[model samples]
Structure formats: C-alpha cells, structure tokens
Target: MSIAGLLIRRERLARAWSQEGLCRGICGTSYLSKIEQGKAAASEEVLALLFARLGLSWTDDADGALHAQTEACMEALFGGDAPAFAAAFARLRAQERTLLCSPCAADYLLLREFACEADGERRPLDAEFVSFLDQRQLALQRVLEGRHEEAALLYPAAAIRLWQGAHLYARGRYAAATEALRAAYDAAAAEGYAHIMMNCRVYLGNCCSDSGDPKRMQQHYAVAQRLAEALGDQKILSTIRYNDAATKIECGDFAAAYAYFSALEETDAMSLHKLAVCCEALGRRDEALTALARAEAMLPEGEAHAPERQMLALVRCRLETPDYLHDERYGTLLTDCFALLRRERGAGYARFHLKWMLKWYKANRRYREACALLEDFPAEK
Candidate 1:
C-alpha cells in the first residue's frame, strides 16, 4: 500500500470515521484515490491543510491501532497474502470478544472479505470459509432469542456482538457501538474479504451518524465507498451510495441529499427506496411517488407483492398516513408481506419489520393476521 492509503486510513481511524462519513465531506473521493496510489503527491501547503483538518500523519513511524491497521490494510492494497493478515487479526480479535462463537466465527468474516476481493482468489479456502459463516449464523439465532443480559457474558460471540452493536447504534449508544464495530472491523479487515470488510465499514459509519459524529461518519464512508469502488461490484457500490445519501440527509444537506437520492433512481432497490425517501424528504412527494411507481411497474406481477414492493407501500403509507393504526389494513398486509418475505427473501431474516408484525399482532388484537402469518410462513428454518 502507498502513503495515500496509509494516510487516509490513518486519518479515518483517528476520527473513528467510516466511508459514508467521508462521502459527506467536500473532499469527495478523487483526492482519496490519488492519496492511496501515492500519485497526488500533495505539496507542503496541502499536507499542512490536511493536518489542520484531519490531524497529524504517520510519516512512516506512527504507532497505535491506526498505524498497525494501516500496515495490515496496506498489505491488502498490493494484493499480497491476505489470509495471513486476516488469520492473524482474527486471533487477536477472538481474544477480546466477551461473547463470541470462537475464532472460527472471526475467521469467517475475514474469509468473506478475501472472497470479495479479486486479489484473494482461492476456492478451497472459500468453501471452508463459507461453512464457518453458515455455522456462525446458526449460533446467532440462539443469541437473538436469548436474553441480552445473559449474552454479554458469552465468549467470542462475534455475530451476536455485532448485532447488539447495531442495536445500540440505532438506539443512540455511540461509545459502546463504536467499540463493538471497531473490534469486528479490526478482525474482519485483516481477512481482506471485500463484502464483509465494506459492510463493517458501512455499519460503523451508520453508528457515527446516529451519534451525530459527522467527521467520523465521513471518514468511514470514504473508506467504504473507496473499497466498494475498488471491488467494482455494482450491487455493493450502490448500497454504499444509498447509505452515504442517508447520512447526508441526517446532516441536513437537503440539496446534496437530493442529488444523492436522485442517483439511486438509476441503480437498484436500495437506491430506489433511498431515492424515494430523499424525494419525500425534500417535499418532492410527487417525485418520490413516481419513482416508486416506476419501480413497481418494472417488477413482474408475481414479485409485485414482494418485500421490496411492500416496503415501498409502507413508505407510501408514511406519506399518506403516518400512523400505523390509521391504515388499519396495513397491519394485516405487513404481516402477510413479511411472512412472504421470510419464505422468499433468504437474507430477510433479522430484518427490522420482521418482528414488528409479530410483536404488534401479539400485543394488539391482530391475532387473526398473526395466525395467518404463522400458517402462511413457509415451514423452514
């Protein structure tokens, strides 16, 4: 890895920033690209300017997690032996988790990262890696159902740990949230798996934004966006863009948010939802409705009742009637939709709305809908 990657990552770690965070800044990523390749070669004045805003640089001699992770991150930059670093990072990470599924779970994240990057292509290793992920997911199901207080004591419980971190961040718990994601990221990035690595960064940025940490948000966003761009995966990149836009909306850059959301219209689902939200946020309700309408038109009839379509209905519902109770029929529809999603959208497990229906129906008088959901839900684990 060149000095640019080192410096950029260094600054990012210092501020506890993520890619979506950095994307919020005026810096954009073009300058970041130059820094990573050592191509920009900023003048003394430019270096001074950076230090003022982002703080000091390593100049090849810095210490701490930033420097150490910088070295590890650099190895991945040039396409070296990723698993070595990934495995090493996993060992250290496994030791720190108060609750975990052991080192294998940590290794799974690393392996996922390695598989995502073109440089770390090795099939047998990938199969072994995926097996670990499958096991880890199973382990997670137990934790989610178990009481949270009981869980804090489990050793090396990686997935549950991250899930808790996500929960805390969403609920506005910044410091604890940071600690969790940072630990997970340190372990996973060492593996150099593109998807997991980027994902960790994205969630970390989400934490920062929720905490009102704009600078931190920008840093992580920048790195995540850069990594996604490097991986050249359209789907993942689009996801990063949607996330970045969401952060900007929170920051109140309505115009910029508008552009970011508009860009999503040209992409896929995450983009579609994000674009609709952005339009709605800007009081361009008509634009938002039209975008969702076009997306709805694009789907085949069978998929019209899919989660994506139904989620759009929720957003549309939000505009027409904000109260979950106002749209009395919505509870039934949402229960039915999530039931359909639980069967169809394999990755829809643990989604936000999945349990919303279950809990609401149980508490309120929607027992019929809840019963229908249970019966309609495909009998699968």
Candidate 2:
C-alpha cells in the first residue's frame, strides 16, 4: 500500500461515492474497492477517470511528485536496497517523457548523475554539461568571495548551494567547496532543513580534510555525527564513520584510523585496501599482506574494482620485491598505475597512489621524484 492509495481512498469516501458508483462504467465494483484498499494496482487511465469523476487532478503537481519520486529512488540507493532502487529507477525512466517539461527536470538529472557516481559508473561529462557546471561554479565562487550575508538571498534554493559545493569538491576545488558548503549548511540550519544541513556538514567536513584544516573537519564531523544519530539513518551513520576513518588517515593517525577501519561490519574492498595501506605505513608487512589478500577476495570476480586490483597487485609487489622502486618492471607498472588513477578516477584518488610513491621516493633518497609528486596537485585559480 502506498501513500497515494490512502489519499485516493480518503478522498473517495469523503465524496460519499460508493465503489459501484465510482466504477459504474469504468471498472468493476470489486476492482475499485481493491484499488481503494491497495490490494490491486490502478492503471493510469483508471486513476485519471476516477479523479475526473471526483473533480480532482490525478497528479496535483507533477513536478513536485516527480521530485519526490526521485528522492525516494535516492533513498533506496542510500539504504542499499538494490531491488527497490531498481524498481524506482525503472519507474523514473518510464516517466521521463512525461516529465520532460517538469520544473524539476534538472534536479532529476542531477540525482541520476549522483546515482551513477555513487555506483562508480559515472559517465564523462559532455562539453555542454561542463560549460554549464563551469558557469555555476563561477557564480558560486563569486557568491563565496563577495558578500557573506547575501548568499542565501542570491540562490533560489539553499540546496542548490550544496550541489555547487559537491561539484566543486568532486573537481578538487576544496577551498571553494568548503566555503560554499558552510554557507549551505548555515542556510539549511536557519531554514530547519535538517537533512540538507546534515549532508552539508558531512561534505564540509570532507572538504576541510582535503583543504588541510583538521580542526574544521573535526568540528563539522562532530555536528554531523549528532545529526546522524538523531536522524537514525544507518546510511548517514555509515557515511560519517567512513569519512571519519579516512580523515584520521589524512591526519596521519594511523593506529586510530586502523581501529576505525577494523571495527566496520561490512568490510568492502576499499576499506580493506585502506586498512592494508595503514598496516604498510605502520611497518606491519605481514598484516598488510593478509589485508591485501582479503581485499582482493572481497573484490568482484571480473571487470569490477579494476583500480583496487591494480593497487592491490602493486602493494603486494612493493612488499615482496626488494628495491621495488629501482626495479624497472615495477617502475613501468607504477607509471601505468599513476596514469590510470589520474584518468579513471580524478586528482583526489591519484593523490592516494602518489602518497605511497612519495614515501618510497623519500625513503630511497629519490627526492627529485618525491618533490615532483608533491607538486602534482591541481592548480588553484
């Protein structure tokens, strides 16, 4: 039974129409009663006919309804309900043609983009999309750089600012993203949009980590943690915990980070891979090797987690092959790995591989390579 069914039943009874009267020439009385009770699904034509008889619209506001549906789809994805997510996605695709003129069309597209990215199946941005993003980013930057108080007044919705911040963060514009995210957070807080506020805080915390502000990162994480707790959303709680562990690594708190990683229930390949890196950093070679093996086992059989495979192989080779940096085989492999990381993922991910490479370079007195790696960050405007 859906909320729509309840609404339809309530409205039908309020009009004092018997099931036989409502269904007279359109459907059987049993069918109408079943539809009212949610035991049978009503086709679009049936709903339209019934609503017309009741002097009401079948879809009150299609745009808002579509947006709500999209949000429901996203919620399923976040909760890891694959079957529900698939059904919702199929429904959205089927309704796309009807929703073409919807005011929330852009929002639906953005949500789809987010869905793809989360699944690690993101498509390359077209030139037009890139151009649109560039313009929005420029506008967000201007807002952040100029008036502090007029940001919310300038944007039509506070949530748009959060989207801008997320875009900036994904593109490695951490400082700008941090500012935009903070502004979004404050506006969401003022408006009592608790979900948006919590999300802003989480992303702001991540951006702070990327921008080298551990204090700000911790502050944002603390607030987001409380929000996640109060909201009682497992997805939000898991995301916050994952980011907290990753931030611990960024802060060089390897032991604490390892503890956090080890405590996780669902040991995904990424977490195991990170835990292996932590073990390697702490000079626990045996533990690192075991973790790497577990990570590899956790990875899907074929055509999935390619980057993790490359990384795991590289990590294993580096561990076993003495003078790995000096070896020509590993040297070429490292170059190929670096190229793949940069091209396939982004600067954020490439940095992880570079971190280990830089450490090895420094250890082996390859200061020139180490320095060059250090300078490989995306150039700021």
Per-model clash counts, in order, read: 31, 0
**Per-prediction CA RMSD (Å):** 21.1, 12.3
lDDT of 2 by residue, 264-311 (tens): 778887888888878877888998899899988988866556766887
> What residue runs in model 1 are displaced by over 4 Å at the alpha carbon?
1-175, 189-196, 230-234, 265-270, 280-285, 295-381
lDDT of predicted model 2: 0.67
Cα deviation of 369, candidate 1, in Å = 28
TM-score of each: 0.40, 0.62
Q: What are the runs in model 2 whose C-alpha is more than 4 Å off?
A: 1-156, 301-304, 363-366, 378-381
Q: Alpha-carbon error at 168 in model 2, in Å? A: 1.6
